[model samples]
Target: MENTRFNPVQLRRARIARGKTMTVLAKETGISRQMISNYELGKTIPSGNYLVKLISNLNFPKSYFSSGQASNLHGATFFRSQSAATKRARDMQSVRLSFQNDIYSVLSRYVNFPKVDIPEPLDMNVREMTDEIVKSMAMQIRERWGLGTSTPVDDVIRTAEVHGIIVVKTNMTNDKLDAVSEVIGGRPFIMLTDNGESSVRRRFNVAHELGHLVLHAGVESIHDFTTQQLKNTIERQANLFASTFLMPDEAFTESLLSTSLEYYVKMKKYWKTSIQSMVYKTYQLHLINDDQKLYLNKRISWNKWRRVEPLDDMLKVEEPTLFQKVFRMIVDNGIMSEADLLSELKLPFDELECSLGIKLNNKMAVSEPKLRLL
Candidate 1:
């Protein structure tokens, strides 16, 4: 049954998930911006023709608007793009994150997901962290996870999932956002933008977020109690962690015969990391001087290898199986059908697929969300 009682939080969530700002939604719904705000703020609920406009425009089940207990995340959410992604964009992403969490909450009861196995954040703040410390943490965790320095992480995504971290890819369609990680319902979930890039690129991005999960505790956003320099420090430290974890110090140093672009390009296959990242790693390790680093960068730009690196096309991108298996076990095994989900959870079809990282195939199977234009 449709919920006539409008819950403002859910209204705000629908607006954000639909990627419509209030002004845009106002124009689309043929309603005043202030009125839209009023409805979302719960000062007054949209009713009658106003409600019809909202239902038609926003495109969420009417029941969703009044779904009980729309939980909000207050934890520190780490984004790959700090300065690039706008606040509104991040808010939209967060709303989706909450929706995904709800999906997880419902499905998890039926499926016992793997126990989370990542190490705790280091006992230090961003201010107290150092380059050496960050690298050390990365190495330690590798050994802890039974991955010694030299072994190429053939499937970092699977490694993360096996260890209890939820990884999913969604098409945020924003170049700025490569990945985002937030601890939801006491589980750390990493959302990678479903950009069809190199597996090497995906590996680095996942490692980068893993760095945040391990090294940067008590430091979530740039807006936190951190100066821009501290933010840069954490960001760079994460990069260092990614590099060190993927290309361990001892093994990688031995592998670096030359700082030339050709040498790193060849090494990319062995390391299963990007040539660009490997070049920067060589410089960061001080194995290559400024002039050599400058020369390599020039080579990268000259060949246009910065964006699409050599062999990026050949390397298969890693896929997250945890969520896929969860859904398969649930729906494929007849625990719940798509219609059952809509009837029970009141989820938007497209949003549900994106959140769970699985398509329902037949959107027509679910009942039309009791939302129609009058």
Candidate 2:
């Protein structure tokens, strides 16, 4: 506390990380709410006992407060169901994303992760996009990435990781926010809610955000669009991207022999897509009529497959392993010890775990044979 200067941004960031409002933090620390506001605004810096109260209540290390505010990245955060997500929830996830971004930066200094790879940049004019255009673009990505010929994508998560996207499952407070994507320091990060969703849903979320990164992020300020209708339109396009990307058009139409739920349960085994998505694609492909689509919906509701589909438990849940593998490589190889990481990042174990998605399962006790701090 003596050498480290208090960063007001860090204080606000930590407050949101713990999902604390100003008044709630005031209650926890027994500090006046007005003074906490002043401290965060940088109108006044806390000294003596006030500082100790924040340290005790927040559980962040002294060095964290000293670190300068992170620079805002160029790309805006793209959130699914923006209208449905609460501001507080968005704030918490954004801070968590920034932390994970920083963790990525620190780790990249020791090793290289995949760089952003796309066949080409997408059409800048989002207004001109249609279902056909989106489908064509999805096909282009499938071919460019060598996902395989008319076959089910072996692993969308693995494809993303191999092609230079870092995907992490986030512990989202809001159920509405399925996923978020932002370009932090030129690196794209996609965060999905780790809410025990089915494997197909999780895969769709990742693909949707990848759509944002490819279709919307650099091309425009999509998140800042003023109207909800436009947002929904863009979101629909991304969904098309995901659906087409997951279930290829020609192959899907060929294999969708029946719209029956029992038949789709087997399709789920093959396409690894939810029955709903497959049915929607079938309708879009003109293989099913409106009446047929309605009948399928009724059957889905009757079978209770609307929310949790068949084979959800049976199919393997896809997760990102690039970070986990790299982190172990660094620590196990003595590139950086656990204590050194804790000291360097200046975050408590839980907060670090929140961002990095790794559980070290140890307190910050001073261990023997200390390595040089980074």
Candidate 3:
């Protein structure tokens, strides 16, 4: 029944995190668009009935609007296909990243998450980056991570989590954006799309984002590359990193017994890589001549295997469970109630579920046991 103090930035974050425009939020909450804009701009504050309505609609605790530290994705964010993505889509993902950072901040108080373990920054000039240099960079990373050339990465998401990289799967349905990675608070964070892509493609996407984090650490902004040539070069470097990182030369070359599509299909299960990727890697390694490579491409196009491939359903999709497990520990160990956790996060039930890829059964109170007196 009283007025509550509101932070304009928090209000804006809540709206962006929900992917709602001013008019849409206004209609949903029965508030005027002008008033919402004024509140977000710090010109005024919501009070009494309006404040209650905001709390109910935003699903944020009243305290959240009053006191909280705000963090943003400060470093460069490498979208898979930046040119194809719209500005609104990028902003929505950025808001989602900020929300994830807030969650990480809350969890850090109770649990110690893994420390970030990205490789040292490369000293090569972006303009002079060659395929050979990129391949060597990938090799160095493998050595640093203790991943041998022959060893296949069983689960890229788990590997990243263990190495202190926070991986989140987002519910962004945009086909143009496969994934994006950034550095925040001196840590690496990657967000993958939950677009029902095959596990193999998902793994490659994770690796590709990792490539951006390592290769473009010093670049200011992805858009800073004004020339299409420069942009293509950097993207090519990341692609090379992903290819070499996933399929090392020695082991991958050894497995290439033939240049036929059928051979690659059989090898797909062993490498856990898409047949197309394997075909490309084979050509990159020069195991198959250009003619052979062109023929293979024609075959892939003929069968439409570019979009869907064999063994796509068989390979298990890697997911991040660390955050969900930590949340469960906080509740199950009595560190915090589900209500408190949700309130602290300022996320609605559906958003929380989507962000963490887990369901929330909010009935989390522990029941007291009866005592028997003999």
TM-score of each: 0.93, 0.91, 0.89
- Residue-wise C-alpha lDDT for candidate 2, range 25-128, written one tens digit per residue: 99999999999999999998987578778877887776777776654546568776666777788778788788777678778888888878865546467767
TM-score, candidate 1, is 0.93
2 versus 3: better lDDT goes to: 3
List runs of model 1 lying over 4 Å from the truth: 1-4, 225-227, 363-365, 369-374
lDDT of 1 by residue, 63-140 (tens): 677777686675578778766777777776777777767777777878998998877877477777788898898998
Q: Per-residue lDDT of 125-169 in model 3, one digit per residue for the tens?
A: 677767887788788878878888787887888888888988987
By the TM-score metric, which is better: model 1 or model 3? Answer: 1
Off by over 4 Å in 3: 1-4, 27-30, 51-64, 123-125, 226-231, 362-374
Order the candidates by lDDT, highest first.
Answer: 1, 3, 2
Clashes by residue pair, model 3:
none
Model 2 lDDT on a 0 to 1 scale: 0.78
